[model samples]
Target chain A: MTSPIAGGVDCDLHPAVPHLTSLLPYMNDYWRDQVTTRGMTDLISQSYPVNSPISSRPDWRPVKGKPGSDIADLQRQALDRFGTAYGICNPLYGVQMVFSEDMANAFCRALNDWLAKEWLDKDERLRGSIVIPVQSIEKAVAEIERCAADKRFVQVLMLVMGDMPLGKRHYWPIYAAAERFGLPIGIHAGSAYHNPPTSVGWGSYHIEDYVAQAQAFQTQLTSLIVEGVFARHPNLKMVMLESGFTWLPPFLWRLHKFWRGVRMETPWVDRAPLEIVRSNIRFSLQPVDAPPESDTLNRLFDHMQSDELILFSTDYPHWQFDGDEVLPKGLSPDLVRKIMIDNPHATYPRLTVKEMTP
Target chain B: MNVQLRERPQAASSTGIKSAIADCDIHPARATKDELHPYLAKRWHGHIETFGVHAYQGMMEGPPYPKAQPNASRRDAYPPEGGPQGSSLSFMQKQHLDPNNVALGVLNPLNTGQGIRNQDLAAAICAAINDWQIEKWTSKDARLKGSVVVANEDGVSAAAEIRKRAGDKNFVQVLLLSRNVEPLGQRRYWPIYEAAQEAGLPIGVHAFGFGGNPITASGWPSYYIEEMVGHSQCQQTALASLVLEGVFERFPKLKMVMVEAGFGWAPSLAWRLDKVFSKLHGEVPHLKRKPSEYIRDHIWWTTQPMEDPESRDHLFQVIEWIGWDKLLFATDYPHWDYDEPSRVLPAGVSDANRQAFYLDNAKQLYGIS
Candidate 1:
């Protein structure tokens, strides 16, 4: 199949790099001390080890007649398979690096720089999320300020599970920085280090725990909206990343219900939760393998107040995802265009379509 | 009261008596730690201590777990605190069990001694929790039914407890939290099942983080958020274990209800299990029925954190996969994510399906009529 370079932008992609070894120095001293004391040095180890088949080290050559493991090769595969024009590359470290505040910040800075130099520098179509050390607000804001000047940095990436609630006032600084930079903040599910607060206690394993991350994102998003973060920082755009979109409709309804009764508690929240979401929130619809029916998606759109809220994401390399071809089959062409292209263009305007023929 | 009885007869004559639904997964407010402590075993003092006020923190570490910013170790890790007190339960009752809302609520003990591996201590703990629940919740509310936890590690003891509690009008089911039990069909657990079957109490299998089961997720998530998401897989595994082991065949009258496990994945899991059974039929010929059929005949499910907007459609899809009668509505109260019964049902659900899911199905399952 020929790759179609439609002007559409794929909002979720990952540019793989040797895990966060490069950014170790920029972390806060306190976080560095914590990691050293806790003996959690190996936290950043990728699921694939150095000798593993998926590892894409520079020195490793593909066996004769075998496929290579380079970032460019993966990008080529995505381009060939998805007809992707430009993609907002969500790096792996940002999701996985959560041990000490220092380690997280350093890793994010390193990953952002590597992303900028390797992928963004090489192609105008390759935009990136600035991975901020969310544990360290000062470093996170500093990184956002430093990277926002780069046109390719379109969003600040955060993992949904963390030490503080996303709506907590401590996170205001990061939101303010994103607003200042005109960058949307992307919150993805599944981090190796922290578990999201579930209604139930943490389950025994990864699959069960990871599944809660999406719910946590919903809760966090609700926290952010209901706590008046969105109202306080009106310009900040938030994207729920990697989590599936089906559960959102009920969540919005529940939020509105709470808003009605508890408006007194959060009087600063100028509008209903759904309205805030409609105006500011964008969700990336990835792994659409379990995408709700068109009718369900349509109802959700109605409830949330806009179709522009759902953006397209591939969650590349994740198993059990709906490939690009399968994504557009269930939706009308216009909705498909909005999910796969226009919504992302509207959210991240700096992501320009590049002409690439394959 | 006489007028109401006369009115009931007249109402019944007019509407043809709709059966009352029994919610098998209701939770009443737990007794205060001070009230409950006197009844519990001394060793179990630590369990409540670590868990705090809720007794069962569900999957959450009650207190003294590493906080984001730690100052000092908490007083006791055994019973964590700062959870649902009396006020929280009052809020839950107001929201979930208002007469204008859901008419009935079944109270499940938060911390049951049955899941602990120590048989003697487990039994003592179970008894204390049941007593505390009865005194604090069931005694005050007729809308509530009780689920008694028995010592599962010792089936004889567990069965004895079930038998003893079976005759109690307030007790409706035997509550077993998911942990490292042998498959439900195994000979070891059969005594408890038999007692429950004889008593006409359905088995309630709720998920927990510790004991009985190994954590299957790849890594430990640092926060509670990761743990909650990972619950569905555990639910699936538990149900699959019970089904594949022929638990349904061994106890035809026994009903099993999965709680807090969302139904979104049920349709797919049931379909996949049936297909697998078709391919591996030779492996276990003792199971004559399809897995989905067993589920439909014997299994029930409660909806909470009811994935809204699509709540109706999601329930419909599962009903389409299993049968409509197998679905039940529940509000896992006192927990932070408790679904408000009044608002849980989306505006889109058809009346017929709503009646089945919200009322009729549970009525039949719990023999409310």
Candidate 2:
């Protein structure tokens, strides 16, 4: 187990689209005309600003185009480079930014279709997540049902910060639908900006905004656990993609401590908060925010205890790590194998190939 | 300006939990608004009686979370004399100060007038709360000390209030809430810091205030647990704003004490802050030092709702990163989650760390003897 797993499953890889026009061919005539007439050039990216240093690694950024625009480039960099056997492509094209429920629904449909046609259809190793317009639960559930037919669409994608807490009852339908289809609910790190990233009003810098995303992840975790999202949808898999994993240990410790003190208020949360998290929630391991020291990473892991909670991810095109050192400094060989291979297989029920009947 | 060193707690008897020490964060609320009438001006008596106080929360009268007992306090803390919990000094002495052997208990009066909408009324109430602390609690007991409560929104008046109490040895710090109209680092609240620095008082930012925003960034949390855990997030944001916005660089002498906001996240937050600051250094050129350096130098943290990691080693690791010297002992007296000094830490912690944590550091910070 000391050797790195070559055919590791990459749970999160972004397939970038340069502009809204790229999806126009996939959209119906009514929505296409509406978008073009409105001069909606490109949907504003809520998470990654185009020119921000965090958007894409310098070497990975295209010499003359979008970072992940080319299928050949993604294959070369993410799959071939990392020896990834199966890579789940998550296209963050700002389709979820559309305000109107109808427009948002149309964009989500177009994005899913575009992903199926362009990336998933082109590569056998590539899997995709259905980007849903989380603004309207009805439309979000409808899109989930529509995409459930495609086995390649293995997960439901939504932003971490949105119109409301994902755990709220209004959004539980999305979770229920995903559970029915065996699609893991993948919450990406981004915000709708309906509110400030911090509890205080808007921050002054991008650094503040970027650092505050960790807190958003923490809040949403509590929301999901306390709101009984896990209890109702027992089999649901909630994957927080591009959300750093190091913060989870301390966050869970504090959550579980408080739960012990105030469990009566949330009777549905019968188990300890940490237990609920280990059993239901999984976090992507890229953008590891732990200190570079091996000891610190080991200490964090000791607190976490469970091997299945972290899923391997390259977070392709994003500049989280400098080189091939996507894994933190000091994870044990067995834990690495679990994170890179077995964990992702367990998290995404559709990722594994079934044995042929003799 | 001679600094006085308090007598060391008769050398850690057995478990190394000091019996006699300064309790940095002890909330002493008024039993009723009528108790504060003597401290308030005649002009605002009618205003208080008529309009009452309006806090920047979802509800008009109570806090957002109803699970917190009526006063948002411990039921056991309610005085036998029929007043609210923590309102009676005699009961506090018997229940907390006497049994706990608190040498100096700092009064952090909340819910009196800290988050009110009316600036004049808010300032008046804050002043009255401070006076009420001295009259009913601190002045009566020689071991009790008051924290000058200020209406943070009105910096001018808040500063004036600080100046008035500057010479009083009984008041050791200026009390402000983490949830304020703006981040404490912003210029809008600088006057309070300036006065605090001038008065040689540290600013103790306690959890729970009405900063005109929900406890969470998205909205109000559904349960008491979310609200409780969210306290650290608010404190993190405040501390980040204070350090990154160059508040510490401007007022070099100003010290901050993060009360009831656990320190487990401090080391992690500092690491993240330094990581972000190195890249965005130009945005805040005035910050002469690293974010962690300012935090280590200017800020002190109180251990009340102390973080409980799965292994005792994890707790020690957090303490190591935060530096034992930076910690000040506190028991959010009368609060349901109050940490007893003897039992707070895991068994393996050394006597030296325990002594510094419980007594020495806080005594030095407050110049208490």
TM-score of each: 0.66, 0.94
Docking class of 2: medium
Judging by lDDT against the true structure, name the best candidate: 2
The regions of model 2 sitting more than 4 angstroms off are A1-4, A353-358, B1-18
Candidate 2 CA-lDDT value? 0.82
Residues A60-133 of candidate 1 have per-residue lDDT tens digits of 23343122225666566565466677778887653345566765666666677777777777766678888888
lDDT of 1 by residue, B153-244 (tens): 68898998889888787777788866444434446777888999999999988765344222322223323322343455456666666676
TM-score winner among the candidates? 2
User: lDDT per residue, candidate 2, B19-93, as tens digits?
Assistant: 676788888877765888899899888986787778877576666777545565676678888878888888888
For candidate 1, what TM-score does chain B get against the true chain B?
0.78
